[model samples]
Target: MTVRSDDTTLEITRVFDAPPARVFAAWLDLGQFQSWIGPEGIDCEVELLEPRVGGRYRLVMNTPERVIPVSGVFRSIEPCRRLVFTWGWEGDAIRQSLITLTFREIGGKTELTLRQEGLGSVESRDGHVRGWNSALNKLDHYLSGGARR
Candidate 1:
């Protein structure tokens, strides 16, 4: 995995031991997505998911001490190739961001690149870096047969 960030944007790249279609499905399928979306020890509940362009999704991440709700609108979807979406915390309008994900097939595996922009600050971008990395690690484990349900 690799990460790059600036004050307003962050990018992370990870290679998964699965095909592009499989990896992409994990994001679009609600049950699959709920299985590996949050950091370790956090449980994610997907409230709504509509996989097409202009669709909307909402999910809540539950930790022992907090409930974090996030919602987004799908801006683009390209099957196993790419996705673009608008993301925001439930009550925070000023911190809205745009996220783009691109998947590349490499030797039967998938390389996923995630880019989030309009973060508003370096601190916010850094927090997302940690959150996304942890989530992606779970995704890796899930795809590798460790956390698959």
Candidate 2:
């Protein structure tokens, strides 16, 4: 995976050894999402999920030390191609951010690009960078047939 970031935005590009539809499904499918959505050692529970545009979703991520609650509203969804959403922690001081995901087919594999904008600060963006990279790494393992964490 490749990562790029600025004070207010983060972008990640990763290629998965799976078809575009499969990769896209991982994001919208509850079982698949719960199986591989968090960083190593973090357990994630989907509190609610409504994948259609204008729908809402919520998650509770548990780590050894803390519980993080996040929720979002879908802005757009295009099967096997793209998704756009609003993301924010349930009670955080930070403002809500927009995330866009693009999927491209390449030689039977999928190239996924995730872009997050409107982070409140560089520190917030960096934290998301770390979290997302770790989560994506776990996703890679999941796609390669590893057992869920």
TM agreement with the true structure for every prediction: 0.96, 0.96
Give the per-residue lDDT digits (tens) of candidate 1, residues 30-133.
98898898787788889999999999999999888989999999999999999999989989999899999999999999999999999998889988999999
- In order, the Cα lDDT scores of the candidates are 0.92, 0.92
Model 1, global lDDT = 0.92
Off by over 4 Å in 2: none
Taking the tens digit of each residue's C-alpha lDDT, what string does model 2 give over 114-135? 9999998999899999989999
- Listed per candidate, the RMSD to the true structure in angstroms reads 1.2, 1.0
Which residue pairs in candidate 2 have backbone atoms (N, alpha carbon, C) closer than 3 angstroms, thus clashing?
Answer: none
Q: Looking at candidate 2, what is the lDDT of residue 77?
A: 99
